[model samples]
Target: MKRIVFSAMAACMIVSACATAQDGTGLSKKEKKAGWKQLFDGKTLTGWHQFHAKPGSTPAWKAVDGTLFLDTDAKASGASGGDLVTNEDYENFEFEYEWKISPNGNSGVMFGVNEDKKYGATYSTGPEMQVIDDAGHPDGKNKKHNSGELYDMIAAPKFYAKPVGEWNKAKIIKKDGKITLFLNGEKTAETTMGTPEWQELLNNSKFKTWKGFGEYPKGKIALQDHGDKVWYRNLKIRQL
Candidate 1:
């Protein structure tokens, strides 16, 4: 009788814990156990928005063999604005993705991008996670242009990216005022948000000329084309 009462109490506690732990996404206990929510369905652009292109135009974003690929062949002359964004807005969260780039290609993943298209381009508003082929891309002329860096503003400690044509893992965590970048399971760069040093870096960056740069509190996420052939997979995010 004592064992039965103990089991009943434990079951009630588990139910209460689950009820309180269910997030806004209504994920099951098993799904939330991994602490990540899939941003892409791998089959369609369901929870994403394709902007900067024409109203009905879709820019080279297609799912092939379970990988989301950006085929820039359709976009010649480097007519930019091949940025796709998430439907949700995030302030403090953890992001992870696997990417592969063609030789000499260029691309980026932008976060904190509060969409004010009337103001200017995406880079002017979002902080970019620089994505490029380290040894092959022209932007890869230095450590700042390499993968897993904070895109021209901060440089990674070392080149931890795999060669072109191979998948490389990357992660980003934004907790409170701290932001960290990771490459291939190693921490690369980190900075405190809204600090004088960070503001100074922004003022000196290419985005300096643009208005409202890194001034948003929270915003949607964006994937940039930048006239590069890049592929992304297993993109996931977890809110803190």
Candidate 2:
């Protein structure tokens, strides 16, 4: 069944091509407006990819009551892995999404990913925009669990996360080697990518053991399911 579905999709892609404009991460006014485009239509997963295990099954992600929900209940049965990635690849861009985590839930949004199934997660190559329950999760005690942190690596500028079970806004801008994290309309963290300093940091971190992490110039965006219920919506992006 999965093969049949993927074959049909493959057939369609061969017949038609869909292109989206940029997210305008660091472009001038004219260039920004010219390339800025949306990735989600607010209703479907037309441009995303599920993990390798379910190559042909519909993603566990779904729209419920106008919001995107990542169901973890069904995941325990036979989930290949917890990464769901965008069908499109991006270089530099600004991405925004609203999310709500269940009490004690843990999840993440990653970018600058060079997706390869050999690795355990999207984080293997992409820097994650930490999504966690700051008031309930174990990592909450640490700054990395905050709303805008870089997930165990770089801390967010400040704590701005709402209580568990409430929706919070988050954004990530990646461009020209610089990365910025924003939460609920406030800037929280900023860092450089692919720099000697960053490499040094990775060299001393868990990612140090992972091969090809952040080696690609561009790749897909991804969502994680860490055995927690997570909700997302109003996801939009513009390239630069």
Q: What are the clash counts of all predictions, listed in order?
A: 0, 7
* lDDT against true structure, model 1: 0.80
Stretches > 4 Å off in candidate 1: 1-31, 76-81
Q: On residues 1-240, what C-alpha lDDT tens digit does candidate 2 reach at each position?
A: 999999999988855432222233322344345665555656676677775545456556775876778877665664344677888888888888889999998898887677566766677788788888887888788755566787767776678888889899998888887888889998877778778877876776667877777677688888887878898876778887
Q: Highest TM-score: which candidate?
A: 1
Cα deviation at 84, candidate 1, in Å, is 0.9
Worst 10 residues of 2 by lDDT: 18-27
User: In candidate 1, which residue pairs get closer than 3 Å at backbone N, Cα or C atoms, i.e. clash?
Assistant: none
Looking at model 1, which ten-residue stretch has the lowest summed lDDT? 73-82
Candidate 1 lDDT over 1-240, as tens digits, reads 999999999999999787667454544565567677988777777788765446666557777776778877756634333688898989889998889988888888888887665845577788888888888877789647778899878887778988898999989898875789998998888988789988887786787777677778688888886877888888889998
Per-model C-alpha lDDT, please?
A: 0.80, 0.75
